[model samples]
Target: MASKLAHPLLHALRAGGPAFGAWLTLPGALSARTAAAASPHLAWLVVDCEHGMTALHPGAGESIAAVAALGPRAPSTIVRIPATGACADGSAGWQIKYALDQGARGVLVPMVSTGAQAKSVVAAARFPPQGVRGFGSPFTQHAWGADVTPGEYLAHANDAVLVLVQIETRDGVANLDEILAVDGLDGVFIGPYDLSLALGLPPPSPDPHPEAETVIQTILAKAHAAGKKWSVPLRLSFRSLPRPNPVTNCRDLLHRGTQAAKRAKEGFDMVNVTSDSGAMSDGIAR
Candidate 1:
């Protein structure tokens, strides 16, 4: 039987190609549909609930449904949940449960600062025997975009779902080696803005301070050495491109295409192109 849980983004990462994607910050299915249909090349789409308008329950579910509606052609949907520290009474676990239940292909937890915290994120995302995720969501199959039985979904979810933790603080950088050592962690994502702040530099610098660059390089090298996938957000410029015009459309396409190529060349396993909010702002400005 065909593997019902196979994900294109997972395949891309395994094949060692950069999985390019866009961030969904808007809170609706229309926005998701538009973004997913914009490019067939997108390997995944991150439904940003942490900083975006997508709420945990209905909004996230709607967005996931919209994207997954594309079926095989849809970019894999991964949701970035709000911050959680360590185990913290399993609040993070509950969030993971809700996201997975709603049919997110993966979950990204932000602000993790230690190996213990990384382990907790993994436990919350995986099922028992490997971790502690419970399986009782009747609607999860819909989000998976496959016609698998519930038993099959449960059996394969542990390996199918991607579990990523953000390394964005001084403590997280200090414990990078230990965090990478945690089992069941699929990858680590760097929040360059917060990382800059943690490094005592200005937040959101176009050019990172030399010290912050060292930390970023260290995380990248260590993740590779541990055979784990690592990612960093790279926001591309949409300015100077007129919106709704063919000229602008060509420019946007070319710009994103170039950025995706550069990210692949840089050896990033996954890359988020830009956020929905950012796109909207850029359009309005244009």
Candidate 2:
């Protein structure tokens, strides 16, 4: 019942319940569809353009549509644009445009270190008066399955499109207060492994270093105190994992069930299916 007016992710967030998400790193529509269908608990799916095999332009767009075709209750598709903090300016605007115009429910901007950068992301993802994002996608309105006319989609999109910034850098931690104060931001998604590395600690091995865990909790508290949603994952990355037997790889979600429960207990807004595409790949069972 999330995003009753539009996207399910928004609906889930508004419902004040912890939404589960699938981490999509692989490309192709079939893969996305499979993932969306794997778990009824899946409230959203993130098309990982940042580090995944999925390309931004056609790939992410196709994935968005693939999941949308599953109907209104199907998981909402969000795009994690592949760019670093350096492109906080208008350079990232076009990428944001592509993702939203393709009918994505949300956009996750990576490595946002300053409030100005977070504002830039928010502005780029929204329409005018609130943002500089342009309109004209005939397909976008259909993606939400409401049969909303262009006018309806345009009117609600500014509020419906969730904009989140990753707080993973040293400067991001230092400026967390300022970033949280920025208007138009929907939430903050913590990148724990990167946060560890940024803070001169090792990447989390299933869990963050003790010090990094402290920081993660601090971030959770800060996000809640600021009245913004906090999103994170059980595992930070799967890029380092070897290409193992597909069946073995697919059991990650089951393996992480305990951590998932722990995350839910900690008041995270949403937690990932697994650290990688493996959890949902090849129609893996939840």
Candidate 3:
């Protein structure tokens, strides 16, 4: 059934290839469209609403629309809403609702550290009977496609929309089993940067401490064991930190590509290859 959906990510996974994606942070319809059409290997694109310049309300919607405009070739849009880490609380409900309401194919909640927290995020992304998401967005069906009516979308959305949570804190890793047990959660996305910081280490400077790497592997194994997918963005976190040499940016992309391939072979379901700004930075530095 997932294969029948007009979702490129599903097609990519089915074809056993090009499961990687780019993260969008620049904020604009043009930026979103460019990233979506950037590569055929891109199976997904995350519209960063948390720390990115894109506003959660109008900006995320526009970006999702931009990707959807690509029709069949568009990578699936997954919005990372604001609220860095919701720990054991359910405070991210409204934010999840806003993103999903805007027609995002999925929602990635950051810093989820507990089973209860995971359940709440799932609830907010799903409709009642299974969860508590409201569905009155008239424009949402348009993003799905011209043939999809509101009724069809509402009927099939619960299955099509993915709800993934970022497991990047000590508590999240410790409670991994419980969080993975949450129903309606499609997968877990690992945030190497925050996970390192939460575990008493610096963010990955192209890679994590040996101990952090061990933990990441453990999480991946545990998620797969529980019959859930594991995902991750570029491992060279440090979005705000500077580099030793701008020239290293080119090598970094190569390193990232290598890492992404290794993980994908290791059973990682989704791996983000780069970002809008990351590519631009590498190009400018070269």
Higher-scoring candidate on TM-score, 1 or 3:
3
Task: Report per-prediction Cα RMSD to one decimal.
Answer: 3.5, 2.9, 2.1
Residue range 1-286, candidate 1, lDDT tens digits: 2356647788788777788888887889999988988887888889988988889888888998888887766888899997656653566888888888888889999999988888888988989999888888788886675687788888788888999999998899889899999999999998877789878886432345688778877888899999899897865444333345645645665676676577578788898877677676656645
Task: Locate the minimum summed-lDDT window of 10 residues in model 3.
Answer: 235-244
Best model per TM-score: 3
lDDT of every predicted structure (CA atoms): 0.81, 0.83, 0.83
Q: Roughly what TM-score does model 3 have, to 2 decimal places? A: 0.93
Estimate candidate 2's alpha-carbon lDDT, on a 0 to 1 scale.
Answer: 0.83
lDDT per residue, candidate 2, 1-286, as tens digits?
Answer: 2244456777888899698887888899998998888878889988999989999999999999898888888988989999787666677889999999989999998989998899889899889999889988888888776666788888888878899889999999999999999899989998888899999998876667999989889999999999999998666333345654455444543556767788988999988756345543424432
Q: Model 3 segments beyond 4 Å from truth?
A: 1-5, 14-18, 87-90, 235-246
Write down the TM-score of every candidate: 0.89, 0.91, 0.93
